[model samples]
Target chain A: MSQLKYALYTGCTARESTPELLSSTLAVAKKLGIELVLLDEASCCGASHLQDFDEFLAYVLNARNICYAEKHGLTMVTICNTCQINTAMTKHKLDHDAELRARVNEKLAEVGLEYKGTSEVKHFLYALVDDYGLEAISDKVTTPLSKYNIAPFYGCHNIRPSELQNESNGGENPYVPTSLDRLIEALEGNSVDYESKNKCCGFHVDLQAPETSNRLTGTALVDAIDNNADMVVTPCPLCHLNMDVKQHHAAKTMGRDVELPILHMPQMVGLALGCTEAELGLKHHVTKVAL
Target chain B: MSRKETHKKVTVKAFRFNAETDYLPYYKQYELEVGADDLVLDLLNQIKWEHDGSFSYRRSCRHGICGACGIKVNGKPVLACKQNAMELLELFNNELVFEPQSKKRAMKDMIIDKKDFWDKHEAVQPFVVADIEEHPEHETAMSIAQVENILDADYCIQCGSCHYACPALEVNEDYLGPAALTAAYRFTVDPRDEAGMERLELTAQMGSGVWDCVKCFECAQACPKEINPIEKITKLHNLQFEQKVARSNVATRHAEGFVHSIKKHGILDEGHLVAYSERAAVVKHIPEALAMFKKGKIVMPWNMPKSKNLDEIQKLVEISQTNKL
Candidate 1:
């Protein structure tokens, strides 16, 4: 397998709240012979919050982060769906709008930075599936997880709004996303088909309307459990937090007793690659991965 | 090979409902033999004409115009006229699940009551309201750029597909949905219109305005005409901030808090974001915050261990602000 290097932008959630995600991601990448260079100096991708406030600030902040990856001559990969979508959308906007690019570059010049739009923003799953082919990943799996039945939860932002779709993997079908399923299969796990597989995990609205968020999260979890998924795995930290950390609250709010283990995508891959639960940070999860 | 031999079988699972007869909605699956070149609308037409005459649905200009054949194909909002039947068969594994546009009251099979959608659109006053006296020639004198802006907004077919696909409207019925807000943005940016501030205020009214959107981007995907409603909503947010509109809304607070936190620490500090954005509401959640802190879900003084590139980020923000003016 050829070596792959990427400037990994671990968004705020992974940096502060989900440290295990970062550790697992690093461990999995190293095991697969992929070099994930951390963009330590990079700030937040200015998420949707920044975009809602000031479009220019959001553009500038993302452009600056892209510039850091470009400086290292590497494409940027993000674990958090919010960061992936935000940075990818910004890059798309800058790429299509030269006038905006010129304006962004003018601001960037003040900080001795310039986004030439050379670097592309990719989700970590996209990197794993597309950059590192499925065959390569399957070959590296030392502990085949054939006994496990995993349901892949693709959070909303990673593949929607049309423009931010990952082009490398048949783009995003929204209704029937196979990227996560392919990854699960590569780990020798059965990708269980379930209703509400593509539904939003309600991570975005968790703050504004907790009840509504819980209801949405509860619906998907219930569907997964009913379909007999051993556990759920997601490519996003926010989704992991919602499906794992908040599962108890969601179940309580919905008047049900639902305990479903949720794993970040890297952690699942780490486990299948023979990494211990501690090494994969599975113990940090609120819902225990009994398997 | 003969054309008959090339045909394929497809199963359509459609939602069936009747306000007069049915007590509850249910799904009815229909099997059909369709040609490769057939559109979903054609398949529906064949089903009604050849298989089941009682199976009712709506369709008009079947060439992707008119926007009449909007329905969910396998849980995705798409124009039946625009979707190739063979491709959909391949995509959904020879079976398609159809339902009337979601978040809408179904009158019958594949038809929804769109009165709520029209009412929301009218709430925004989606018309060019000129401050000056109205004249026929005045409308004709718009520049090419001004005409383009009006045309972009006019692209909406009132299909309600976007309205149905929206998660916000699913939860909050009164939310000024993607289609309505896109129309609101249309009038707001019209060069000849004088109701820019008025329309913005209308959308900002009630808690379900532009701010209510979770930025899910489903509406943009649902639109068959490629009209990006979420982008329009974001532009409306920009207009709200640029015009110095209402400051008390949670959306405004969140935006302001997000920008302030990023400028200060070069990253988002959730504690600061909640404190700054929620203000007094933050006090109400002291117990929750403490619990999170105990569980190590959050770090207090969230803006600690500041970014090394803080100075550079500040410079970028400062320069961008001046450029904005």
Candidate 2:
């Protein structure tokens, strides 16, 4: 029996683009004695794009996912910032709007499911800090990352448009968030503060305005370098992809020589918890893990 | 207690540049005693009147309504007239740093170019263009609910806060930006407007339109009026999908791909999504594709399995139906 359990939601980017996030998340969870019940029945939270199709349909899709968690009697914990926000947005809307909730439950009834609003959504960062105490995590740290000065990148959906996100996801100040910084401190690492820490990753516009997206992406990494940080860690895999895989594109756009290892939040935590690199699927990173 | 008892001292750093007088921009710091109720514009007024007449910035109604007091106070866009100077100092660690909007070209201290901003706003056709001949009776009354539909976008004061806060605008000058998109949304949702579809087509343009929005919430974060300009843009997308307008943008295809993939597998099929969205241009990404494949970022589409409740999800969300996204 695990001490703490959550219905894990491995968002699209994690499941498809970055499996290391899912693997490292699981590895870290096992070490922390946290049980993550895979929400196998879950569908995509629409990735914030589905609302463009049908807001009602997007709401229903997430309502059904939350209903699945309610069936398991556990909180819905997601590793992706997008998933956390999208799910939290759904919960916030359904919990507030009776007519909307009634309609959503009506659609959900077609699948023999009911969203009684029994479950809450949280990011893994929030879950770790809130439910699983930072002190507890500090106790399990076999490898303190004191040598590295890490920059904590809290991406947009995780913090901004704060009304739509879980209010307690990061911190009150969306402009200058400190939760990720505190998490870094818990792992015995120095957190370098930077302007781009809470800015957009430009991943959303990669297909639309490739060069512009790259510049915005590069700005964050460049800001990290300017802040004298060695490595960057993000709670969002989409941020990781843009910062790591597309870093060359960003550098090319900004005309700067920049190379930095971008770690998924779980991978960094996994390292601190003494999990082997192989166990955390470290081989999949685009940038060579400098550590 | 005297009035001085309530006043607190802090340092004010304002961006100083005259374009003609100064070769380069520089920050000039000054000391001031401010009160809790002092507006940022009041401080600027004091700085001009008492500290330095050389310091210059824009000011109009001083009530945050005219949208003239937009500036970057402590690295975030806020109306100088609306924001409390003391609150700003408290929020930003007891120091005030006033600069022009980050992305916009600076004209002088705390003032940026608004010509292009207004040009994009004009491009959106922000007002209603109803078929007046049909309504000879001149009855263009709308119910509260109809007005409520466009109310959020209606709250826009054209402050350029969202416009300046946007990263898309920073990188892509051609991008229509949130203020203009909110304008487009405002008219598109106007029940009385005949040009709703026309506005949609206008916003759906290739390079300079809605698709370029990085979907970052910075626009929403910067809006002083609490009007989430990004949400308005999202509504515009919803309207486009509902109308089933003929469109061929990458963003439209990307959205369609998400719908198709989710309907098929209960989750996204990344390989197919790229192919579906990029079409023949997918070949252009072969280098990055190979790199991703080497790192196991790109998975074999066939190997990806279906979720057990995929059918249940489809049954609920009706993804198989062409009616919804």
Candidate No. with top lDDT: 2
Q: DockQ of each model against the real complex? A: 0.56, 0.66
- Computed on C-alpha atoms, the DockQ of candidate 1 is 0.56
Candidate with best TM-score: 2
- Pairs in clash, predicted candidate 1: none
Q: What share of the true interface contacts does candidate 1 keep?
A: 0.49
lDDT of 2 by residue, B34-80 (tens): 98689888889888998998788888997778998888887888888
Q: C-alpha displacement of B266 in model 2, angstroms?
A: 0.6
What lDDT tens digits, residue by residue, belong to model 2 across residues A1-291?
A: 239998998877777779899989999999998999998888888887766666777788888888889999998899998888788888888889898898888777777889998887888988888789889999999999999999999988888886766353554467768888988999999999888988888887688678877888899999999999999999998889888888888898878998899999999999999998787887888887867
Quote the positional error of residue B70 for candidate 1 in Å.
0.9
> In candidate 1, what are the lDDT values of residues B139-217, reduced to their tens digit?
5466787776554667888888899988777777778899999999988888877899998887776456887776778
What's the C-alpha lDDT at position B77 in model 2? 89
